[model samples]
Target: MPASRTERLLNLLIALLNTKYGLRRSELRETVYRDVSGNDSSFGRMFERDKADLRHFGFDVETVTDLGWSEDDPATTRYRIGKESNRLPEVELSPGEWTVILLASQLWERAALGTAAANALRKLQASSRLTDVELPVGVQPRIKPAGRAFDDLVAAMHAQHPVSFSYLAGSTGKDEQRTVEPWGLGSRFGQWYLAGYDRIRQAPRYFRLSRLTSAVTVLAKENYAPPKHFNIRAELDRLPELPLLTAHVDVRAGRLLGLRQRALAGTEGHTHTPDAGYDRLDVQYRDVEVLAEELASYGPDAMAVAPGELIAAVTRRLRAAADFCAAPVPAIAFHDQPRAGNVRKRTSEDQLKRMLQLVPFLVHNQGLHIQDVAERFGVSREELEEDLQILICSGLPEGYPDDLLDIQWEDDHVYITQDLDLKRPVRFTVEEACALLTGLETLNGLPELAEGGALESVTLKLMAAAGEEGLRAGSLAGPAVGPADRATLDLVRQAVSSRSQLHLVYLSPQGDRVSERDVDPLRLYSLDNTWYFEAYCHSAQGLRNFRLDRVQELQPNGNPATAALEPNEGFPAKLFTPNDDDTIVTVQLTRQGTGLADDYYAERTSELPDGGLLAEIRFGNTAWLPMFVAQHGGSVRILEPRELADQSRAWIEASLASYGG
Candidate 1:
C-alpha cells in the first residue's frame, strides 16, 4: 500500500530525530522514503519541500554538510532536527495565567486569528501542567476584524511580502495605487489601520482598511523587513487626528434629529430656499467623504448646503441609490446547501498533529486519567484510545521493542514510558504566537479584566517565550473599547451583579427624544467596538438593549429588581431577537455589502452573478429601509415589497433634486 502523507512525514520525523549523525539523502531514501516511489530528481524536490514545510512549522530541521566544504553538496548534505533546538522550553503557567489565556483565546470571534487562536489553545492545553479550574462567566467580549483586506494583509505579513491596493485618500477623496510593506495592522478610534512603509511614497504611512477601494494584491515577488522592535499601537497613537472642517447643512424641519444634535447651538441660520421647510445647521466634520456618507443616509431629510465637495459626494450617492432602487432584478433561483453535521471528523493529519504533542505531554505528566486527557483534547475516549494505539506502533526506523513508544492505559489511567526524542512540545509557529499574543493585548484593555496585573505579566512571559519571530507575528492589535465606555460598563456590571433596578437617562435610537427609565440590567456584552447592555425596562415593559455610549446618566433607583427574567444562554452572541411582527424584506447587496448578511442575520441569501447577494432579512419596520439603503451608499438596494422600493427611490430622488441633480 502507498504510504499516506501523514504516515510518511511522521516516519521521516522519527528517523531524523533518532539519528545521532544526520541522515544523508540516500539513507533517508532507503528508509522513510522506501514507501514513496519517484525518480531521483522528484524525490530530491519532494524532500526539499518537506524540509521547508517542517521549518515553516517551527521545527529546526538543520542541514549538516561535509567538513571543509565551502558550499553545500546535495550528495554529502545530511539533515536532522537538533533536540535542543526543536523542543520548546518548558512553560509553567499559574491558574490565573491559564484562566486569562482561556479568555484571551476566545477574543477573536470571526477574524482570521480565530482559527489560529483555537489551534494555539489546543497545543497549550496539551502541554499545560497546571490544575484545572473554572472561571465565572462575565461579559463575553469579541473583536471582529472584518473584511477580506484584513485577511490578505495578515497573510502577506506572515510571508514577509508587500501588498498592493487602491486606497481612497481621505484628504483628497481620490483613489491612489499603493504598494505597502505591511509591518503591522492595528485598530485605533474604532477603525482598523495598517502601519507600514509606503513603497510608492518612499515613506512610512498609516492606511485605513475601510478606504481600500480594490482587492489587495499580495506582491509575493517583493519582500521587506519591518523595523526591529516596532510598536504598532504606539505609532498609530502618535498619528494626530484629522483637522475638523465646518460644514453647513439644511435639515428638513422635524427630521434628522441625529444631525441636528451635532449642530452648532448658536450657528442656526435661515435656509437658502425660502418656504422649503428646512432648518440650517452648522456641523463640524473631519473627512468630507465620511460626512457625506452620513448625510446621504438621511435621504431627503438632510442636505449639505456648503462645501462643494461634500455636496457633490452626497449628490453622487443619492443619484446612485435612486437609480439602484428603481432598477429591476432578475428572478433568483434559491437553493439551500446541506448544513454540515455537528460531529467533527478528524483527518489523519489532525490526528498526527495531536499525537505529536500528546506523546510529549504524556511523558511529562504520567498516569493521567483517560477521560481527563480526552476532555483536554476535545475528543471521545474511544478516539483518544485509537490515537494511543497508533502512537505505540510508531517509533524509530529499527523495528525493536525498545525502539517504539511504550504507552499503556490500565484502570483508565494513561502513561507513556518512552517518547523517543519528542519529550517536549514543538515551539510556537508564527500564527500560533500571533493569535495568543494579540489576544492577550486585546484582553488587557477590558477594565474588568485589567484590574489584576496577571494580563500584563502573561503578555510579557508570552513575548519572551515567542522569541523574535513570534513577537513579529503579533502585528494585529484590536481597538481599545474599554477606556471611553469604562464608567458606563462598570455601572452596568455592578447593577447586574447586585440584581438592582437602575435609573437611566437614555437617548432613543431614532434620536428624536431622550427618556428616563428604571431598568434591571440583565447582561453586558459587546459587538465590534460598541458596548451594549441588555435589560428589562419598566417604561417599555419589556426587554431592551441600551448602547453604553448613548447613556446620559445611570444611577441606582433604590429598588431591588422586580422583574423575573433570565438571560438566554446565547444572549451575548445574538444582536437581535426576532419577533413575530417583524417584517421580512428582501434586498439586493452589491459585492461590498455582502457582509451585511452576516451582520444583520439574514434569513436567506443567494449569490448573484456579479459577486453580489440577494438576501431576505427581517426588520422591525419599513421606516429605516431608506436610511439603510443610503447608509450603505449604493451597495444595497431594496428589491421586494415593491412599495418600499418606490418609497426609497422617491426619497433619494427628492434629495438629489434639492442638489439640482
Candidate 2:
C-alpha cells in the first residue's frame, strides 16, 4: 500500500471500477486499503470520505446491498463505479458545435468559472474530434463574475441551499440581512444579478451583485430546488424599467469628463466661484440613489444643484464619508484568508485529475513522443514521468502482471500496453455543464456568431449529452452584450477581415473632444455590455482602443493597412494600462469599498486596524482623484499625497456647505 493519499485513491478507484461484483468493505480494507493502521471505526470514516471525494470528482460510486429477501443488510453492502453510469457516452458534435464550445471555453478569463469551463472542454475534446474553427480576433468577449459573493452564490446554487447575506436596499438606502433561495444568476443591464426567493419578504426578488454589503453565508441546512422550467432570461427581462429623471448638476470647469459626455447639449449654464468656475448641465438619470452615489463620488468637484432628492442623498453620503474618515482607527486588523490550500495536497489532486484524462488521451493517440505528451498536458517531462510511474502501479487487487496498467516510455515515445478500463473520460457534473452551457447561451444573442443557428444546435446537442442535470444551466448566465449596432459591427469585422484601414469620426471621452482619425483595425472585443475595438491610429501614430458606440462616422479608406497587425492573443484584463511613470497613490478602503482594491489593480495592500484596507494603487494622473473619492461615497479615503487629500476634503466640504452641512 502506498503512503500517498492520491495514489491510494487512484488504486481504490481502479479496484472499484474493475470489480465484477462490487467489493465489500472488508475486502477493500484487506486488499486496497491495507495501509489503514487505525481501528475499524477510523477506517470506516476514511472510506466514507474517500467515497465522497470520488463523487466530488464527478464519479458515481454505486452501493449494492445483499438483501436477504429485501431485508436490511448493511454488513453485506458493497461499492463499485458502474462502467455504464461512470464513463462518458459517445458524443458526436457538429463542426459548428465544436466551434461554439471552443469560443465558450475562452469566454471566462481568470474567473472561477474558467477552470470549470476548461475542464469541460478538455473532457469533450478527449471524447470527440474537433474541427478547425477560427475564432474571431480582437473580438474577445469576456465575462468577469467578480467578488466573493459570486463564488459563494454559485456554490450555494449548486448545492441547492439557501443563503443569507447583507444587501443594501436601493429604495430605503439601508443594509438588511435577507435569507434567499438563489434560483438563477445572470447579467442584465451590464450588471450581475442573483434571482432568488427572498424568504424574509416571501417574494421573488432580484439582487444586484454590487449591492451585496457582506459575505454570503450558505445555509446548507436549508436546501431548495428551483422551479421546473424556470428561464432566467425571461425573468430578468420581465423586470420593470425605472422612470428617467433629469438632473441639473454643476461641475467644476474642465473636470468630470465622464459626466460631461452624458450631458445634454446647449444646456450649459456658467457660474464663477472664488476658486474655480462651474458649468451646469442637464443629465438624465433613472434612479436617484444611483445618480446620488455617482455625484457624491465626485466630492466637491460636482454638485447636484437641482432635484431635492438627489441633493439630499448626495449630501448624506458626503457627511457619512466625513464622519467615517474622522473616526478612530480600529484597535485590531483582520487576519487574511489563506489564498490556497496545502501545496502537496493540491498537487496530488491535480495529478489525479490529469491522470484520469491522460489514460484516455494516450489510448486514442498511441506512441506519441514523451515530450509531446508532456507538452500537450502543460506539464514538465519529469512531472509526466512521475504521472506515468503512478499509472503503471495502478490497477486491480489480483496482484497479477495483467491486473496492473502497463505502460512504456523508455524510447522517448509513450504507449499504454494494457489500459484496464479507463478508455473514456468521466461524464460532466452539473457545475461543469452549467459553466459551458451558460456561456454558449450568452453567445446565442449575437446573430453573427450564431450563423446557421450553430450556437443553438450545439447547445441542444451538448445538453442532451449531459442528461437531465444539464438543464440546470439555466440557473447561471452571462451578460448579453450583443452587437449594439450590427451595421457598425459588420463594417468593423469586414475591415479587419480585408486588412484595410478605416476613417472614423470618434468621440474621445477624455475631455468631450470629437476628432477624425484613420485607424488600422486590430481586434474587436467586449467588456461587460460594451463593444470595443483596438486599432493602430494613423493620426495618433500609436495603438488605441475605441468604443463602438462612440463612432459617429466610419468608412473604409480603400487602402491596405501599412502597420503590421499584432492581434493580442488574450483579453486586456486591465482597464488602466500602467506605465513606469504612473503615480502611486495610497488610499484607505472601508469594508464596503475593499472591492476597489482588485478593481483598480492595487499594487500593494495591508489590513488597517479599523476593519478597512490600505491599498497603494497607480494612476496615470491625479485628475480623477476627487471623483474617485466622491464615487465611493465615504467608503474610500485618500491617505497619502497630502496635497491631493486636502483637495478632496475641501471638495467634499464645499459641496456639503452648499446644503448647509
By TM-score, the best candidate is 2
Q: What lDDT does model 2 reach?
A: 0.77
Give the per-residue lDDT digits (tens) of candidate 2, residues 1-661. 2327778888889888888789888899988889769998899899988898788777899888785522134468888998878777777787767877887876764455766777787788778855677676544677767555787788899889999998878777778999999998888766688999999999999998767767688898888878997778788888777677888888889876668888988664435332348878789987676788788876666778778778877877888777765666443322443222111113577788888888887887788899998876757798899999989988887579998999898789888878888888888878889888888887876676766677888887788878866878888878876877878988998888889999999987544468999999877887666788888899988677889999989999899888985864344434555566888788888755665676677766677655557777788768668767866677787777778887777777776886678
Query: What C-alpha lDDT do the candidate models reach, one value each?
Result: 0.76, 0.77
Model 1 TM-score is 0.80
User: In model 2, what are the clashing residue pairs, if there are any?
Assistant: 138-523, 138-524, 139-524, 296-630, 297-630, 297-631, 300-651
**Given candidate 2, what's the lDDT at residue 158?**
85
Candidate 2 regions with alpha-carbon error over 4 angstroms: 1-3, 69-74, 137-139, 265-276, 287-297, 306-351, 365-393, 405-418, 510-516, 539-541, 570-661
Worst 10 residues of 2 by lDDT: 337-346
Residue-level lDDT tens digits of model 1 in 214-289 = 6688999988888886878778778787688889887889876666777888654544652379878889988666
Those runs of model 1 whose alpha carbons end farther than 4 Å from true positions after fitting are 1-7, 30-37, 69-72, 129-140, 268-275, 315-424, 443-451, 510-518, 527-529, 537-544, 562-566, 570-572, 576-626, 634-661
Name the lDDT of candidate 1. Answer: 0.76
